[model samples]
Target: MAVHPGDSPVHVALRTSDVDEARAFCRKMFYGPLQVNPVGDPAGFAFAGDVVTLGSITVGEISYGADVRVNIADLETAYHVLAPLNGSLWSRHRGTVVIADPTRAAVYRPVGDIDLEWPGDTRLLSVKVERAALERELDAALDQQIVSPLLLGESFDLAEGRGRTWSALVRLLHTELCAEEGLASSPRMAARWRDMVVSGLALTVEHPYGDEPAGLQGPRRPRTVKRTLDAMHAEPWRQFTAADLAAVAGVGVRVLQEAFRQHVGVSPLAYLRRLRLDGVHAELSRSDPWQVNVSEVAYRWGFTHLGRFAGAYRARFGVSPSQTLRERR
Candidate 1:
């Protein structure tokens, strides 16, 4: 998927006193249907908020002036992290219920139905992540095949330590997206930021596979390692996740990671990234500087951040990317 210049950092705001209009707006903003009912007099109800789409993730700030109840059959293709900035939200998912207040946030997975209740004067900050992106990041981080949609624990602590860091990152992303012509407007930077959020969530959220053991305990399979490497080099442009490479090798992610470390001297993802960097170097050597920019060439080969790309390029080749481009020019 090529990113258009104006695709990211898109912001939309809606404010209304009608409950039906509020429900419809929520559905349209998040791409899911919802049943919203007022808990009190409809005349006293009001909704106000803005949602910003940054890359594949959507960040929204919403508020309701009166108590309300909402039911959704399924989120289908997205995962949401809902944190209350003020007031409170009671959320139920897969039989577990949690009150998401200032210190506790709710992680809503894509597979199950969701029910939420908002007290009068409640306000929330939400991060909506694409399901595929989240899954791919998790698989890559764990180096294993995830059999189904992730079932995260109900409440996430936001007041201390890891939770605090994660919450801060979200706030930073939200602030940047709301800025005028933010860094998200740059394709490379946007991708890097999006990856940060996805990877951060994978590490922060509590999951069943969080404690999976690493490395092969028995004999290492050389054939499996070779097969995985061959597949990686065959199509370096593809966004190959750990699960994808593991499937190619016919082994689990931990086994694949161990195999590569024993035989290839690097992890599977690292090897793949090295191949991509090499491809970027070769392309830069062949293209004209007059027509090609470093960011364009780097992005073409899946290098998302320009700063990181430059550092890696220099570390690998002992020359900056611009120096290479100058040689070709």
Candidate 2:
């Protein structure tokens, strides 16, 4: 789990000491029931001075990855960044995630399970931060009032991997915490680490170069795009169209399309569809299924076209919407 605030982001350095204790801790941390059967004994140990970690295989209920599990404390925000200096690890963020390796890295939000497994051994860093910590750190660095549980994106720059100071700092901190002593007092270390980290992140925020999406107005937009996004967010169940979006955004159809395309990367319709699909799928997968059935949930989310909705849901989440229903029992 990755945390932000300078002193409070939970930075834990765990050593593979007692396998039983480690497994139990993993179950508690990663949000999974204790495995009935252990997968591997980490055949051999690696003497990597960086930080060595024992690996395991995940079986049974596979919501995401089998290897790693995380359980977060309330008022705490967790972020997991796997720079996989090792071989490769499977990652699931929103839908069906891809495998990340040393050559590349991926980041997960405050919520979500992360996994890593290989035949032999592996090592990676897990970060956890209390919400207050992340908020205070980011606010101090950015000089802006930032809200808690602020969602740091899962996106990263591969071409610029390990090139920037921010990226390097993460590696250094995670690596150093790999010792028994390091993990024993990770919070203390993390506080200092968060201090340095917030400084770097603040520097990036000030520079505001290639960090966020292109054409990002950074608290500003073409008014039309802003209005359109607000409306869609307000009522996802409405019949939305380009003209409708244009009207709400206070612009013509062409301008609406251009503004959305420029600021948001996708066209208005595509963006709306993405939003609706994300909402509906999230309702299905993450929300309490007891409150609604598949079809009813779909309708509530404005998915009149069942086939189209199912297809989009499957494409995004790697499973059918009904699967969520089936698993409810």
lDDT of the candidates, in the order given: 0.76, 0.51
Residue 273 displacement (Å), model 2 = 1.1
Per residue, candidate 1 scores C-alpha lDDT tens digits across 1-329 of 46755345777889999887888888888866778888868777879878888666888888878888988865768888998888889998755688898899998876456798988688888889988888777665443344345656667888876677877887877777777777765767776777788777777777644332122123333789768866776677788899999999999999999878866567899878877776787676656899898899888888777899899888765567887677654
In candidate 2, what are the lDDT values of residues 219-297, reduced to their tens digit? 5455667677778778878998888888887779998888766666678788667667766655665556666788888
Deviation in angstroms for 127 in model 2?
Answer: 3.6
TM-score of 1: 0.62
The pairs that clash in candidate 1 are none
In model 2, the worst 10-residue window by lDDT is: 54-63
